[model samples]
Each structure stands twice: as C-alpha cells, then as structure tokens.
Target: MAHALIRRTLHAAAAAVVAATGLVAAGATTATPARAAVTCGVLFDDFSYASASDPALAQRGWHIRTSAGGPGVPGATWSAGNVSFPTVDGQTVARLQATTNGTGAGTTHAEMSLPDRRFFEGTYFARIKFADTPVSGNDGDLVNQTFYTISPLRYAMDPIYSELDFSEYLPNGGWGATGPTNFQTTWYTYQPDPWVQDRQYSSQSRSIAGWRDVMATVSGGEVRYYIDGQLVGTHGGKFYPRQNMSIDFNQWFIDLTGHSGGTSVWHENVDYVFHAKKQVLTPAQATARVNAFRAAGTRHTDNVTADNSCTPAETPPPAGGTTRIASNWNNKCIDVPNWNFADRQRVHVWDCTDGTNQKWQFVDGTVRTENNKCLDVADAATHDGAAVQIYTCNGTAAQQFVLSAAGDLVNPQAGKCVDIAEWNPDNGAVLHLWTCVGGANQKWRRA
Candidate 1:
C-alpha cells in the first residue's frame, strides 16, 4: 500500500533504546543450525533464477509487474525490464532498479509480487541491501525500497483492507522529511484522493545503508517488527490484518523533487525471503531457518497451501424461532431496505424494530428473512466487496453462512464476513462481503 510519510520522533528514540539493548547485531551472519522439524507449511526462496523472465519464476507464482500505476512517481512505468536476477556478493539475488531523468515519463520502477493472497498470521523475513545513494547517479533522490503484504482495497477507507509493510526504507526521505529514514507501518485503511490514512508506523531516521535482516512476526493479534534482530515496533488492534495478502517487493521514487540532472539509477537487492505460515518465529529462529535451507542446498521450497480446516460449520438457529440480527457496531438490524421483497435487493443496517423485514431465521445453512428471501453473496462472487443481498431461497453455497462463535457471519463460499461498508455507523449503511477481519463492523448478534 502507498503511504504519505509522517514523522514520528518517538520511534527514533525507540530505535536508540533497542540498539543499546544489544538485541542482535545489525549485519552479523547467522550460523546454520541443525535441521528443525516442520510443523506447518513454509516458503523459502533464495532468488536463484537466471533472470526476471525465467520460466521457473512464473511457475513459482512470481510476477514481474509491467503495469503503469501510482504508489510511485506519477506516470512512471513499472517495467519488467527493471527487474533482474544477478549474482551479487557471491549469491544470486533479486535486484530491483529504479531510474529517473527528473521527469515523470522518464522514470521506471521495478516490482515483483506473488499472485496469491494466502499469506496471513505468519513470520515474514527478508535480507535486503538498502542503498543510501544512487548506484549510478548524483547523490539525492527520494526513493522507497519496500517489502510488504497487501490485500486489495475495495473502496475508500475499506474496513477489512489489510496491509503490513515490513519495511519501507527511504534513503533520501520524501513526504516532507529529511534523508535516510526507514519505516514499519501497519495499515487499517485509507482514502487516496483526499489522502486520509488510518495507520500506525514506526520509523528510524538513520542510515540503513547495507544488508539488514527485516522481519515481522504476526501472532496473537499483534505485528512485531524487527530489524537486525532488535524489536522496532509492535502494532495491533484495528491495524491487525483481517485477511490474506500478496507478498511484494518494489523500488520506486516517491517523487522527483530530489532528482538531479541526468538520469540516476538506484537499486535494492533481496538475497532471500522466508515465511512460516501460522507460526511465530523469533528473528534468530527465522534466520536460522534461512541458513539451514541454504546449507541443505534448498534454493526454494513452498509447501504452503490454502488450508481452511478451521472454518466453522453452519449451526442453525432454534426451531421455528426468528430473531433480529443486529450489528455489533451500532446495534442496528440487518434490514431489507424499504421492505423491498424483490430478489437481489441489497441489505443494509437499520435501527432495530418489530418490522418483519428486520427479522431473520437461521434455517438449514442459510439466514432467511421473514419474507423467505435468503441473505446471499451477490451472483456467487468470491471477491471482496461483493454485494450482500436478498435472493430467492436456494441451497447454493452463496446462500450458506456460518455464524462463527466469534460473532462473524461468514459466507462459506467466499470465506468473507458480512461487513458494514466503510465502517459507517449510521443507520441504512449498506453491507457487503469483505475479508473476515474480526472488526466490529463484521461482528453480529441476535438481538
């Protein structure tokens, strides 16, 4: 996710405290430990590819972004040409090069992403070499070298959108700041046009000029960020990721303000990346795993699968009993707007009343209204923000829902929850299918 830089002086102090505590050396080499038993799925890649276009790369779910977009200098093309796999410091590494000639059209950014959005609640570790100065240009330019995970933002200030930026290293800072700052930001949601953001970030305003271990452990509802084995920040609450996200790495210019004269080129190098699904590993343990993989001559491994074994089964409500399903956010009932009985009419939250339109019964695996229309995922769509509407009762998975013990009303087909759009607390706010982030807007109860 793109972010406007905001200074947090407290984080600088926190970095100093961490440095004094001797948690771990910044660039120390980790010793290869004995092979450990793998209790869960894991992915480790050492970037041993011939080039960005290598067939093996695509087969392994890697994509070299060739799209044109924002999150960088406006009009700057994200070019596959800028991504390369080369030998650096005696090891094959994925290298991203971004160049600019002090003009939007003359700039090119590099990004590589995994197509799957199945990563959630895991330990993410990477060894990256950050450059404070351009590899072949005049000294100053505002560049962001990043490694992050993000789910699509369906709408402005989407309540269930998830992003965890493990690291965004700005060698020459942008967004109204000075040079050489690094940030670890956890996102809740944001608006792009007016630029309003709801997030928590920790930054260190010193040079992160060389290879460093950047790690994040997501567990027990908190995201803990570590650099070189020292704890840098811990963010939780609303910022906790509510869904799976793609793993990505990119190098781009925040803007051209710091760009000077002739074309300048910058580079970010990634030696390896590791992820342990549903497991929280310490920085030391993560590094040890990386080392062990290398020692065993395993250049890449991915045993991670989309495991939904924990999904709760549908439990029907009491026989012949009907109740009002109210949102935990505002105590408003799930209502068919205007008492509309037409099929495919979207549902919304409204003040609870004795109206039959607001009354619901859990029968079979579906939540049905007093009028017999079932709450369904529109057109059986599985994407985020799919409409939650009333449709003629049918035994499709789209109409099946499980009210999990945690209060989430989940559509088993989409694996999403019925969410009050945009976190709006007012009556008549529309509801839609969104990632189950356990947010108040996704929680419901029988009232």
Candidate 2:
C-alpha cells in the first residue's frame, strides 16, 4: 500500500480517455507476432504454506508484516497474526485478514511482501479473491485489497521512485468516492505531508466479489493491466517504473469511518503468483505458463537474478570533478579519436593525456565529455561485442553506465562490462561489451 492521500487525485486526462473510449471489452486480446524462445528468468509460487511462520515462505523471500505502519488507519497494527494459510476451495491459499473495532488502535492490517526489489519489466500474474462483505460483522468499511509493486522513496519526488498498483479494490470506497470500485494506478512519485502525487489510474465501478485473475505486463515503457484477460488500463510516460520493486499483497482499512461498533473482519486470498523477467506475455500466455507449471507438479521456482552487479550512484559526482577513465590493463585513458566530438565516433583508449575528450564527468547515470557527448552503447545494442561510442545523450538505457566499487564499468541494461577489446593494451585500443569476468581489460578507474 502506498499512501491514502496518493490515490486522491486521478489524472483528469486519463479519466477523460476512459470515459470516452471505455475499457477494452472482456475477452478482447491483441494478436502479436510469435517470438523465438530466449533464455529468461522466472518466479512462480503456489504458496502452499502450512502457516504464517512457515520457514519455506521465508526461504522463498516472503516477509509477513509484523511492524506498525501507515497507508492505512493511523496507529493501526500490522501483524503477522493477520496473515494465514488455509485451504479454500480445495486449494491452499495465502489469506490476509484485516479487522477493526471503529478505532485506529483497534484496527489491524495485513501485508506480505518480497524483500528484494529486483522485479522490473516483467509480466506479473496473481489470482486473488476479494471480499466485498465481512465474514462476521457489518460491511461498508473503506477497506483496500491490493496487489502492487513498489520501490522505496529515497526522498520527496524522487525521480527514481517506481510503483505499479495492479489492483486496488475498494469494496466500500475511500478518499471521498462511491463504493465497489477497482483501480489500476501507475505511480511516478509522491510527497506525504501537504499531499502531492503524480500518478495515472483507470477504474471500473462494480462488485468484484470473488476470485479473479489480475495481471500487468511491463515492457517498452508501458504498463498494460488486465483483469480476467480483459485489458483494463494502459499507462506509460513518467508513470512507467524507472527502477526495480518488491512484489506485495496487502489488505488495510482506508479509515475507521465505515466501522460501526463491533469488530469487522475482511479477507483477501491469493491462490498463486508468477513473474516472467523481461518478457512481455499476454494474459492468455501467462495463464498458460501457470497451468503448465502446475501440471508439472512444480510447487515453486525462482531463477530471476540481479540485472547487474554495480550499484547505481544515488547522486552524481561533485561538480567540476571530471577525471580520465583509465583502463587498468594499460593505464590508458578512454578517449575520443582525434578530438572528434561527432555522434557515433568510436571511443578508444589512448595514452594518458591532457585532452578534454579524455576527461569524463559522471552526471545522472551518464558519462559526459567536455564536448557534452555521452559515452554510449552504439545502436543501443545489448549483445556482446557491441561497439562503444560517443553519442548525443538521450537518457536511454544505452547511455546509462555504472562504475562499480570493484572497478567494473557496467551497462546495467545489458548486464555487460565495458572492456578494452580483446585485452588490447596498445594506444587506440577500441572498447566493446563483454561478459563481466573481472579481467584486467574490463577494469577501469578514475585517474
């Protein structure tokens, strides 16, 4: 759950578009060309846990919330006790229960999340059962049942903040809205106090009272959301996630306003979840994959690995601190051939010199020369041996590089190291991409 205030303002333009065009009709699907199979990572969990304390759950990187938190009724307790595994409809399911007695302190929220913020640009799928009425008490609490992914907010309006709300089902409605509305929101960033937010959402108003397939596909800068194989919304631009995020499912009370007196208990159930890293799968294709896994008796599987070894810098280097990027193999500085600053000029290593082309400044994930040309991967290629050159900075992933503490300059998108081609040590040795093997030719440092 992000914040209560964050969902208050829906983008007017998005709302207008939804009103005019309407959501893609149920069972509507787009045909896409078949792609050749590529080696990709994946994660799937049937969530057949014995209890909230199941060691297998923790081993699989799941954390049940026991800490107190916001994004719910203030002072509400978030407890591990609220998360349980039970047999429902002959299937083991993860269940989250939220209860309230008309007071903040008397409310308890439930949440389960993965600790690793490594999911990005993938197809996420979950089968969830959302309840519109409490099992034991009166209904009408402003409860939120959600399946979302989020990265930490380093600061107010952090440009790298990423979050995608696949579904936020409001059975009774909060933030001054009517009941039984489901929202799919894509977030850019937000501020807590004084309440500011940048987000886009599409909503459908109706009773979604049972098990439903909720999926979101992230690729090519856009996030397409589908419910039961029906396209519900598509959002992109700044709202597209810029960093990795943790997958989460939570149920919390928006406020205690709907509570009458007695304790009201609401439940959200999750049958399973799946993620295909860096792959764009349609809802039908994703469902087929899930079925195949189950048919093969696969309980759980996880092969998703970190995209790169380098941790990105939180802030750019100090101003006026440009330095020569010297290759450890020959102590030669990365240089622009013959002082040419033209786009697509191949960058090479030259003897340590006083040339401005050899002086590079680290700025917002890009290495820039004195002539304002960026060190970029030619053709935006991610394959091995892709050429390295100087190009106009366009803020694409090809222009992003992170110099690691271990001295490897890595293109995170390509998961490759900047290497002196073929371990060449002579002046004018060209640069290219290669698997990070920690070789001398792949190591660089500021000189």
Candidate 3:
C-alpha cells in the first residue's frame, strides 16, 4: 500500500485484462477522487443464514462455489468448501476463503453469485474486508477480493455478454503490480478472437487492508465508484453494461506472476450488500437508505427488486422552486393541515394564508411539505380514488409525484394523478389519486 495512484492506461482492450489479472492499472485520464458523505439505494443482505446451502439462500437466488471456473489464473481453481458463513464484528458475514493446501494443485477459489440474473442498473453496496496476509500464516501471496456483475456466456464466445467489476482489490500485489490497489472496470465484452470487446476502467493504489465500505452507482449512463462515502472514480461511455448481470463476490489468487502454495487460508469478509435498482442515490442518500434498512431489522430482503432495468424519472421538476400550490380550478391552496407530520394525515386545500402548511417544495421527483413528509398515496394504492395523505418520506416511488406539463401532480409508480375529492374546494377537501383527465380538479398552479 505504498503507491499513491496506480497508472491505469486507457488501452481499451488492456483495461479488462489488467483488471482480471490484478495488474495495477495506471489511468490515462485523471480520475477525480470523491470526498463526500456516502449514501445509496440498495439490495441488502447481511449473510445471517446458517450455511451456504440454506433454503433461504436458494429462495433469495444465492448459490455458493459449486461451479468450477477460474476468473484468476489457470491453477487458481474453485471449490465449494472454501466458502463459509461465520460471525465477524457483531454479525454473521459471507466469508469467502481461498486456501492453498501446500501445492498449486489443491488451490481453491471461493465465490458466491446471484443466479437470478435480473440486475442491470443502480447503486451497489458491500461492507467488506481485504486481508493482506493469511489469517494464521504467510504474507507474500497475492489475493483478490472482488465484487462484480457478469452476464455469463450462453454459448462459447457468446456476443451477448457484459460485466462491471465494481471492485477488484489486490491486497498483496498480483501480476507485475504493487500491493493494495483497487479497480472499477466497465466491460461490454472481452472476446478477443472473432471480435474485440473492450472496457473502460479506473484504479488507484491505497491502504485498505481492513473492513471497508465499497460502493458503486450505475445511473444515467455513468458508473461511479466510492470508498466509504467518498467518490473514487467514474466510468462511462459505450462500455456501460449492455445487458443484465448477476451480482458476484469471490476471493481467489492471482498466481501467474508469483505463487505462494502455502497451507494457509486467506479470507474476505462481507458484512452486507445493498442494491437499489432504478434509483441513483447520492452518497449521503445511499447511506440513509441502508441505515433505514438496518433500522427496520432487515437481515434479508428480496421484496424490493431484482428486475432487469431501472426506470429513472423522465422529467425533472420545474425550475421555479418552492411555491404555493393552488388548484387552478378552485384557487384554494394545497395544504398539509396544521403542519401535520403524522402518517395518513389528510392533506387538504385551504385558504392560502401564506402559512408553511400551504407552502410546498417541488424537488428531486417528489413534493415535500414543511418537513421531510411527502404527499403519499395511501398504502401505495394503485386502484382508482386512492387517498393522498401526508407521510414521512422514505424515497419510494409511492411518494414521488411529478407535476405534468398539463398541470397534474402524477405519481408515476401508481400510474395515477393527484386529484381533489369530488372537485370540492372546502377547507378540508382532501386529495386523492385518480385517472389523469387534465381536468380542473387535477390542474394546479404554482403561486
């Protein structure tokens, strides 16, 4: 961990090769280091299962190292026994161990992957550990701790392939490079025979020999890498993944340059991983999302999404800023009665009064009142005439309301527009979600 920056040359073809082989890449283009609060949207897993073959794992699309494949060198083989789940820090973590039983013939790699293959774009998070030396013995071996996405080839030399190595940590140096270097490689394909598929990647040399929070955000055609909550590098352009990928984590040796065939075990610990598809949260926002999940006592959840694509908002909020939201038809101001913060509190149209309750902030694809509460569709209802009430904002599409060009507040997730009950303009007339009609009750004017 002595070098400041690994010189990652932008040889399109060599980027993928460098990453796969654990070569310390020197960047041709300067990668701006990000220093900010870490945050993201996530798919979370705390590895609380009893074993790799636990029923909960199959239900959640996880499988251990049963498949024989080498992402490393030819001698760096894979085996199932090298993978285990043990308590680390205060929680059970997915532990991938690569051990060489005194000979290269018995070396084994440990990997776990999501077999669902539905993940495409979004932020990715994993709290992990990178060991520079063996837990009990040895210090000169080369090991890789990786978190990546891959669209496995359906056939030999399949053209429909993609991969994004969000992180490839070479803790003790591999190939011809120095130790403690990290990389983020965006690959479209690595086929070099009939066709040449290239990649875009960024890398740096630093000391990360302990538990580190690694993050990646894939949104708006850009791949941003983060350490802890600060940005490290960004990758984009045509090499952005062309298809969905299965999330993967593995620990293996990069033994082509030097081999340490010692009878010792090398471990990589992952506390949890979080993925939020179709959502690109800022570092602070991403942290909050994961914190909320932990707060809710979630050790495992597949209820959010493992879908193919993320549907980002098409239109941004109007640039005018916070204003008085008055129904164009009745001229009454949309209000969060008495500045209510309670869930399901009825939001109504009252006299403008210019009070905080009557004022609204249109920001980041959602509408917020005086505080963190947003106008939420009750129960995230999709059926017609669902009530629109005040609720604490949790960054769900249910709370995301888009003001349309035709003048209606629409919740795209529900495919419903915000409307007033029965066209009423009374002081307590509540708001609801109905089919968008571009009608008077659905139209609002910012004052």
Candidate 4:
C-alpha cells in the first residue's frame, strides 16, 4: 500500500511519534455511508514458490520489498535474500527472516506485498506464524511481525487513501510499551503536511504466542476482525477505506533508537493468504474452502476479479441455505417441472425428497428459485386463478408473494394462495392461485 513511503528513509522522530501515539490503543467510531458495493469469488495463494525468482509469485502480484528508509531513519533494510520458502508441517510456506547485528537501523527485513488494490469490503484470510521467540538464539528483541493492507499513498487527502493492519506484533515492546502486544487497526488519513503526520485510526489488542489464523470481513458498513475463528473487534466509521488496497507482510524491529535492535535470524511463516470479495463465510467455511483447494493441489488463481457494477449482497448461494419449501396439501415437495431449465415452466408437486430443487428463498419481495429465477403470476395477471410459472428474475411485484400467517404463499396483488389444480395431490400437478383456503393443500412448509 504505502511501501514506497514506508521503506524509504523518512523523518525517524516523526515516524516514531506516529507509531507511538497512533498505535497506543483500540476503539470504535461511527461509520460513514456509501453507495452499494459489488462482489466476486476469490483470489488465493498458498505460497508454494521455492524462491522470489519463481514466476508464480510474480504472476500473482507478489513483490518482495528490499528498499530502504521508513519508520526508522533507514527502516530495517528490505532484503529479498532474507525471504525464503521452507517446508513446514509437510507444506511449503513463505518464510521471512529478519536479522540485525545491533547496528543502527540497518537490519535485514523480509517483506512481500501484492499489487491488487481493489479488495474493499469482503472476506480476507491468512494463516501465519509469529515467532516472537526466535527459533535459534534470538529473542527479547522488539520486533514487529506484521500482515497489513494499504492503499496508494498518493496523498492523505486522496479519497482512496486507507489502511487496515490485521496483525502488527511488537514482541519486546515498542515505544515505552511491553513485550508481546499485537494490534489490529483500521485507518483514515489527514495530512497537515508531507513529512509530519496526522492520521486517525481504530484498533483492537491481542496476544499472539504462536501460529494463528487471522481474518476480516468488511461489509454491511462495518469491518469485522477475527483471530483463530473468534471475533476480536469491529471497526466502522468515516474511516472505512474509500478504495481497494494491497495485502502485505513484513517483520522488522521497532527502531527505538537502536535499543530494540538485535542479531539472530528471526522468522515469520505464512502458510497462505486468501481473499473472497463480498463473500462472508464463517471461519470454518473459509478453512474448509482453503483445505479443499490444497487437497486438490491448487497453488494459486486470479480468476476472481472486481465486479465494478454494485450488486446488493443477497442470501447465501442457492446450495448453501437450509430451506426447502414443501407442499402440505400434497405432502410433497414443490420442484421445478422435470428439473428443467426452461423459463415459464409450471412448477410441479413431487414426492418429498428434501432436495435442492425444492429449495426456495424469500428475499426482499420475491420468492426466488435456486436457479436465480422468480415464481411469477403469469403474464402479470391479477385474476383469482392466474397461472403460476417460473420466469427470469425481474425485480417486479408480479413475481412477489408473501408467506402469509395463514400458511399460504399469497400473491397480494391477486389476494390468492398457490394451490394444486382441483385440489389434486398426485405427482406432477401444476400450480396456480386460488382464493385463500387455510387447508392442507393451500399450506407450505419451510422444512
């Protein structure tokens, strides 16, 4: 996000001041309003590459940072050499090794950042290992093991300028603080000048002792933070990022005037990093999805792209909900005729099977089929016995029906309930509307 500015030599005193006051605590604020948002499927990476030279990582928008000059006068030297891909637990993970020889702020910091910045308001995930205590002899150093997101630092006033820090670990304390305090922060910037800083942010505190799964979902006007499948905090306000951001990870010292510097190759491992635009899945669902991809031997994919046209988030995908509407009168399930895909097909009553074909979603003002079509009052007729048919969805009242308290799917326009022809219960019976009859045949069940 702000790699160019963050890795370059800047005002150390100002940067230290920003890190001190800016990262002191966590809180919430009022969220700002915006237009509707869009969504796509996913972009995933398992970090299966063996080195930075691997084209896979580059093809997937990955760039290892090895520039200088940042929070410290010369932020830990970004070194591609310190980046590695080592086998861990039978899988290859991106290994970032940070080393310093107690010199000035001249430590070697391993970091990588993605190039995509259109990832606003969606689910994100990362499996990481914050080795606070070095594997070898390094320990007690105030190192920061981080995973974050940032927008182009064009200018603080740039509407797209935003940042979200999922994990910023200070193992040996930072700026008058103690060891082992992890942070999750959301940011909005305000610049009084170029060198000096005045940015606003909300944050949450956490303690990470080992490998942990981190995730966040930015939707419904809020940003939700989670660690290891547990809710951590929610941030919403005028600060909600105005645009997409690049994902990043780095491990470096806090640069407390060299007091926090130390030697010994310390490392942070990343098993994977994933993103699903506008799709909010449970931690279990996310893990399962990732596991499935791994089991299928998938290393990376960019198939999921930005959907510029905003589409309102609807109910879960057709196959995800636990809803099957059954016809009580027929004691059977209401399914599409012959499992056909043709529009205007009369819905039929079939022997109860509790299958996906019988599934229905009553969203907004319409009862929709699993196929993204709508149950319609044929030809927009408002007669008592108007024909009922399946049709391509068009957000129209003609396709809307309410689940009445009387247990009837009543088309309010015609004031009639969906019923089987002649009160028949045989399989393949066509459906139509009739005067509300509070009887078994007139009733439906969401079983």
Candidate 5:
C-alpha cells in the first residue's frame, strides 16, 4: 500500500476538486514524453461465464460478489451480464441490458470481488455507447445510467463499496432529484457512513454523450477523476488505505422506483480498457496511452508487453540536500528565467538559484509550483511535439508524484514513470519522466 501524506484542512476544497477530475494540471517544466517501455497490463479482461465459469473467478483471485440492491430472490430474474473470452485482440468483454419499469426504463448493476488483500493504485478507462430513446416526456428525454464500481463484499451489498459514476441518467430530465450527465465520485468508509460526495469535481456541469472515454486513478492517499483526456478533480488524502480493489463495470436504470416505469435501457456495447503497468507515468505519457487505446478500439491488449529497457535519469542531489522530491524526479530545481506566460513554458532543473519557477511542492501527491499551480502537458499531446507548461492548480492525478524507496520518482497518473535522460553522469542533460522498469533511469541519488 502507498503511504498517505499528512492531511491538511487548508487545501481540502481545492484538493477535492482535483480528485474529481483525474488529470492533474500543468506546471512549470518540460513535458515528459511517453517512453516505449511504459505499456499496459491486462487491458480488457472480463470474468464472465463465456470466458470461464463463476467458480473459476475465485481461482484467478476474483469473486462474484452481490449486486447493489441485493441478491436475486424468488421471482427475481437477475441477468449475469454476458461475457466473451478474449480473442487475438486480447479483450474480455461483458454486455448487460437493464429491465424496464412501468415507464419502460430499468437499471442494472454488476460487480467483481477481489481475493487477496493488497493496496494498489492505478487508472481505469471505460468506453460506452447508449441505445435509442423514444422521447416519452419531451424532446431530449434521455434515460440511462452507467458507472464503474468497486466493492468490498464477496457478493451484493453485504458490505457497501465505493463508486465512480460516469453518467447517471433518467427520464423527464434525469431520475427524480438526480442530476443529468453530472456524476458523483464518492468514498464510503463503511456501510453505515454516508458517502462523501464531490459534485463540482467535474470540469463542466454536462453529460458525456455518444461514445465517451472516462479515466480515473487512485494513488498514495489521493483519488483523481478524468474525462476524455483532460484533468478533472481529486480527493482522499490520508483518509483511506490503498487496498487491493477489484474492477467493476455496471449500467443501471435511472429510476429504480416507478418514476419512469418499465423503460428498458440497452447499452449496445461497452469497452473497459485497462493497462496495469507497475511503473509510474507522466501526464503526457498517460494521455498518449489513453488516446492510443481510444483509437485502437476494444481489440488492443498488452501488459508487460513493452520492452523493460530503460536508461539512467536521475542525478545525485546537491550536497546536503536531504529532501526527496519524487523517486523518479530529479532533485535539481532550476530558476525559471524571467519569461512571460506564453502558450509554452518549458520548465527545467537548473542550479537551485531560487527563482519563482524553481520553487516546488508536493501538494496532495501532485507536483505543484510553489505558487500553488500544477505543471501541465501543454495541449495534451503524446508526440514529441507536445511541450510542458504550467497552469492553474487542478487536483488531477497527472500532477501527482511519489518518491520510491530507491529514490525513484513516479507519476501515478500515467503509469509510466520518470527517468534520467542518459548516463552521462553530468547535470546539463535534461531529466524526463518515462515508462517505468527497474532501470537506472528510474533511480535517483540525493546528496
């Protein structure tokens, strides 16, 4: 499990917003490019009857816990969302449709239970496309809900779990009091405790329509939310442990009650692509992977498929500099020359001349300018064309970093980590964040 930094009330609101968006903001620095070594692990693996029997789930360290409301009782025909084993494309797909209520709409929920007890921090992306709607109430009358869930129970709501709802919709402009398109990314301490909600966590108060890709990451003591390729919000610092959480994809009715009775919502197809790389990633690297996976459709798959090959990246910290920034981040902090806030503001580690840009802080896990802003990947590009820039602080995970025991710096957002440019053993070369492997590029030495 990752260590939780000390909690502070002063930055709670701001940090919560960051936790909601998933992507971290830009800061003063050179945007680290995505290295080939950093790749995905187990991109799409659905454990349904098609791939394996329900019993086999336990053998693979997964359990079919219960549903949201409860187990299917007598007269209740619960559908075990259909699953298809992986093909050459390497994808485990699961499909489920909700039952309609009197209003012709229904809600469905599915979950996956994990076996071992471990604390892991990573990102998840889900692709979704909804079916037709017959505008019962009025025009633009859409009713559907989709969510990515995490449960602590072996089945059902035996023990309540946490949830990251991408889009929760209903007829007549959303389910009763529920908001439209806007989602609630919450954390539940226990079954009794009410879920802590962050409503403004999203970058906008709108719904993601058509085929949309949403990403989320949890690291250290922080949890961040992202949409498409942009950073959104962040939450949870020093609150919960990084436990071994299972992955779940669910679509349910907007109004379980008879608000919009008997309306069935069919999600034609869903693609939840995951890459479990053991290394940390820079925002640029993570965005690149997301875009690539988005373009690749649901057929792409790879975990540990990339070359573990890496190069040295860190330089020894100056004498007496005991402070560790991030294990993969070079301790060198250069002064930001007196430059205007142009479109591109590449940050560099120079002699700690104590300039405005040189000052840095690890706020809620994300690396931030002492001025309280985040270092950003200008224009969200994967190619070398992208430049590193600084922008207003947003608590997306992309800005978060960690210092490993080996003095290596890691970015939980990208899954790929930081690395030294080369083994020149000199200070002039630039330090960049790249795909992670156990290489000198991922190691650092503080003076």
Candidate 6:
C-alpha cells in the first residue's frame, strides 16, 4: 500500500483549520476498496546460482530460515545436487541424495512457503513429471505447494499461519504395478479450523510417464483444481487470506523405521519449472531491467540502492499544506516526519510537500506512521496533561483512537479530544490524548 505523507502536527493543524473554517466532521472515511493493486514479476530459478555460493540459491525465492529447535538433526541445511536427473526405465526421474538433520523431522529448510500477496480470483498452475520408481522406505516426502510448510518442523509453529499441500505419497515398491499418484489441496492451522481442508484425489493410472499440469484457481472463496486443463475437484473455503512470503522447493529422503529392511524411498527426475503470471508484461523495453540480470546469470540484484539507478527523496512535505512548529510541551501533536520518532513531541501544523516521514496509517485502532511506528501514551495515567509519544504499533486501548464521525480524533481513554500538547502555538508541541470536551481542540476536518 502507498503510504500517506502527513506529519501529526500538520494533521492537528489541518484539524484546527477545519474547526476555524467551521466545517462539519464526517467521522471516518467510508468505502474501503475491495481489491488492491498488485506488483507482479518473475522470481529467480536454480540456474541463477550455477556460478556462486550455496546460500545464493535463495535468490530464487526459497530460503533456509529455520534454526531446528527440537530433536532430529538440531540445525538447518540445504541439500546439494546429489540426486541425478537421468531416465530410469523409459521415463525421466529426478532424485535427491541428501537426508535431513533437525529436531523431530529430519533436516529442515524454511522456504517462501506462501505467496506474499493475496488474490480474490486467479489460477495457479504447476506442471510436474514424477519418478515411476519409489525408493524402498521413504515415501510421502514430496508434497504439493504448502503455506505454513515453509519450515520442516510443524508442531511448535503458530497454526494461525496457513498451509497448502498438493501431493505427499511415496512410490510403492510392491508388485510390478505402477505406484499410485495422489494429489491434495488442503489448509492446515495449529488451531483446528475444520473449514480449511477441501479436496484430495488418488489415481493409479497417473504415473511419471507423462506431463501432468496441475491448476488451482479461486473464485468467491472457493478453490477449484484442474488436471490437464480439465476441472477435476472443487474445494470451497479451504483457503486463507493471501500472504507475502516466498516459494520453497526441496528434495530429501525419509527413514523407514516401521518397514522391513528399511528401504530408502527416493524421488527423482525433477526439472522444468514455471510460475503463473497475473499481468502481461510490457514491451521488451520494460522487461530490460529483469532481462539484463537474467542474461548476466546474476540471479538477482537485492541491494537496489547501490545500483546507482535509484533515486533519493528530499525532506518530506508538511501535512495537508499544514506546517507544524516543534514544542516539548505535553498534550499536543508531535511534529514527526513519518511519525516514527520514539517520543511524541508536541508540535503545530503548516503547509504540505514531499517528505520521507509524513506517511501514516491508522492500524487496527491506533494511528501509526507509515514507517510502522506507533502513537503512544507516554505514561499509564490518563490525566488531562498525559504525554503522547511514538513507539511500535501494538493493539492497545490506549493506542485506539476514536476518530469522530465528523473526523475529529478523540481519545476515549483520556476522555478528551487531542489538543495542542503544551497549549503552545509555537513550531513544536507535544500531542496528547485527552477527553472530548467539544472545544476547538476537539474539532478536525478532512484534508
């Protein structure tokens, strides 16, 4: 979301001007937009790291962000390319020769387990060809796209985090018949949310011989899965809101503690990957930046600021054309650029312009700066002269501000409307939460 640039003092000055002009307050803005503009791009692929460090593999969207806390191998590790992509029998097979070491679940890696963005309706497609041969003991190692599955160790993590699994069965070695292929799209949470799981399908006829295209599309909160471009199953509400995380891909072996002779089950022949695109890219010129890096085999350029192609901004403009004077007095709007200063210094408002620190968002019930700092009560006591300060955004009643239907900001906790913190008309003054007394201090109008 684009952050709004406006200093707290300027906001107060805007309010004061509204009161001076005798404009009626309208409380909060109505009509929150339903959809958001999304930024789409091509992430990296494994080929990007063919030249550099192993950690550089993460440039492709997968990460090893875990510290393995419990039992298994006690730490996180990335598997090197030991598995070969040779054709076994008449089919191509991809296998990983590495094992995991961590607490409980072997060695684990944290990946971009989920999408960082949310979508109300769109189709996600993945085409994969699997190995016909199932290793002796380790089956169920490879599963489809999952959310909370970012980390291998699942139990201790917060369940509120979401997860999705497509397939998770190992190759069957019994008989000469082809192993059964299974697919699923399920949501998992720490707290049992029954409505999350939607579909699962199993087929013996589906094997590693041919290309299988899997598609997932959501509409009206319902998810539909398509195989080979044909609708196969429908899952409704088994989904969660879209999140901003990266994608993860891994291949590992599992132990056969229960089976005879402990056959090491393995998955092989993994190659040819693609991610669905939401927007059609622009002319070749627009893709030049991406293509340049792609051609360089550089994988990615994370530190954009050093590229010398970026621009810097000057001091941010005042809020709503309202310039605020600074003051150390209490009970006033502090003039913080971006409202990220630790202490809520009182100040007055003035004119508007561009500035890095003027942006703000009223998150939950608290007014927070665009930089993610919070507007806070300097102390616990809710007296008339209580000081206001800037801190991190935490959902607290003290931080919960009541913007009147008329647009005036009110602090019900202090039972007062925000007034000049020190009652100073100078450049800076502390902004504080106070009772709503319907005075000029309590009046504010829209910018």
TM-score of each: 0.62, 0.63, 0.66, 0.61, 0.44, 0.38
lDDT of 5 by residue, 1-447 (tens): 011111111111121121111122123234553332222223333333344355655544444323234321122223455232333234344444444433321333333323222214555556554444432322233334444433353222232334444333332234233333444344433222232222222324454555555666665556666666566666664333323333444434433343344344344345454534333444444545445334423233222222222211222123222332322344454333453333345544445444555555433233455454556554444332233456554433344355545554555445444554553334444445554555655664432
Query: Tens-digit lDDT track for model 4 on 1-447?
Result: 121113211221122111111001111132431111112335678888968888877766777876565544254577889888989888799998887766655467777877455467677899998775776655676677888777655544555567787777766656445546666777665342454433433333345867899998887768888889988778877767776666778787665343443456678989998876666778877787676456535576443334433232233333334466687665787788767747888887888775666777754335677666778888888655678888876545466565644466766455467778787868888888766545577788776
Residue-wise C-alpha lDDT for candidate 3, range 126-145, written one tens digit per residue? 88987877886566666788
- Please give the clash total of every predicted structure, in order: 0, 0, 19, 10, 78, 84
Ranking by TM-score: 3, 2, 1, 4, 5, 6
**Candidate 3 error regions (>4 Å):** 1-65, 72-95, 100-108, 113-127, 154-160, 192-197, 217-237, 255-263, 271-334, 338-343, 353-381, 390-413, 436-447
Largest TM-score belongs to which candidate?
Answer: 3
Q: Comparing 3 and 5 by TM-score, which wins?
A: 3
Candidate models: Cα lDDT each: 0.77, 0.77, 0.67, 0.65, 0.40, 0.35
Tally clashing residue pairs in candidate 2.
Answer: 0
Error of 3 at 177 (Å): 2.5
Tens-digit per-residue lDDT, 299-365, candidate 1: 8866444442333233334444698999887899999988997999999999999998988987544
Model 1 vs truth, CA RMSD:
20.3
Instruction: State in Å the error of residue 422, model 1.
Output: 57
What is residue 277's positional error in candidate 5, in angstroms? 5.3
Candidate 1 clash pair list? none
